[model samples]
Target: MNLFHFSDEGSIDVFLPRVKENRKELPPVVWAIDEEHEFTFFFPRSCPRIVYTRSDEMSDEDRRAFFGATQANIVVTVETGWYERIKRSTVYRYRMPAETFELFDTIAGYYISPRTIVPLAVEPYGNLIDRLIARGVEVRFTPNLHPLREAILNSTLTDFGIHKFDNAARA
Candidate 1:
């Protein structure tokens, strides 16, 4: 399967994992939809947030309020057979698009889109790349720098500097 990740230009050549030493607290291994959507969903610690109509309806103020001050980043694509395996092994919770919502059950972590699945904890993601590599995954990077020149320029998370990884690089 082809999975997509978005990140800043500086990280185009690197894959940064949420390691205990660097993060102190564990974080999820996140990815975005390969295709575009009017709204992009994020589950930062099981609290769902949406970056809605970033290129259209949303105002700059709302963008900053909802997504913070950030610019476009690179998009990463990886081909792996692990998505299903990971999804199946992990327990997930999801939500639909709405203007506002309150968080429930703090431990599940957040997931966007009606059925977007995510693991309950960050532990499995700790060695996600390793598992992907063990399963023979191929990772590739695509830079989303030029707003007028790239397809991903319109992606909701483009300005958020999302990052993706290629396990092959480690080998």
Candidate 2:
């Protein structure tokens, strides 16, 4: 399986194992995403986003409530304040050696490694909105993520991810 790491930096010689401030409880590790869920990182590093997908086990009622009439299997929501940044930002996609990583969160397509990692290659990615749309992903822009956060948590959206919420706008 192909694994990747996304960054805003144009050039990266190597990726070192490190603990994020929010993840200090865990050991330092390199993070990578599998090809299937790379869409999760198609934004600036600190851009808060909520991503949800239609699961195979989803009930029609839950699907209708969460997905509405949209045919998109995946929905990604970001605050409106980040819209301009999302458009102007250029993120680099770094291919990683799958052998050095192990599955971390299967649902999120996340992988972790205790050892340092060197990217196999790096490629610049732009047109974030178009890329997401081309992949049949519905991208949403909201003023605040607070309400949506609570709704998703209480709803049947099991296949969902709330990212960098601490950086999200306050309600």
Candidate 3:
């Protein structure tokens, strides 16, 4: 399977292993996502968002409550303020050879390499929001993600990611 790294900047030539400020408990490593879950990064970095999908453990009641009749298996939600930025944003997808990376988070599709690496190629994706919708992702915009976050955390929507949520608007 192909692996990729997405960034707002496009001039990256080398990816060095570095610990993220927010995730100090983990060792320094270069992060990449597999092609199947690339949709997870289809937004401006630091955009406080939540993405989730139906999991085998999820009850039918929860599935119907969260995904009504939507055909999209994946659902992503961001605060209302990020809407305009999402519409105008452009992200660069850096393709990486998966040989040097090891599976880090299986459910998240994350792979990590302890050593530095070079991207095979970089491709630009503009009209970020449009691209996400085109890929069959149900996109949502809410004024405050606090309630949703609490709901998902308390519920069975376990196959999910809440990225940069510390930056989300307070309730």
Query: Model 3: per-residue lDDT, tens digit, 43-85?
Result: 8988999999977899888898878888778999999999998
Clash count, one per candidate: 8, 0, 0
Rank order (by lDDT, best first):
2, 3, 1
Instruction: Please give the lDDT score for candidate 3.
Output: 0.91
Which candidate number has the best lDDT?
Answer: 2
Q: Specify the poorest-scoring 10-residue window by lDDT in model 3.
A: 126-135
Q: TM-score of the candidate numbered 1?
A: 0.20
Worst 10 residues of 1 by lDDT: 38-47
Candidate 3, position 153, lDDT:
91
Full-model lDDT for every candidate? 0.29, 0.93, 0.91
Better of 1 and 3 by TM-score: 3
**Deviation in Å, model 2, residue 154 alpha carbon:** 0.6
Tens-digit per-residue lDDT, 1-171, candidate 2? 999999989788988999978779989999999999999999999999999999877777888877898989999999999999999998999999999999989899999999989899999999999999999999989899999899888776679999999999988
Cα RMSD for candidates in order: 15.4, 1.2, 1.1
Query: TM-score for all predictions?
Result: 0.20, 0.95, 0.96
Candidate 3, residue 49: how far the Cα is off, in Å: 0.5
Residue 115 displacement in candidate 2 (angstroms): 1.1
Q: What lDDT is reached at residue 91 by model 1?
A: 24
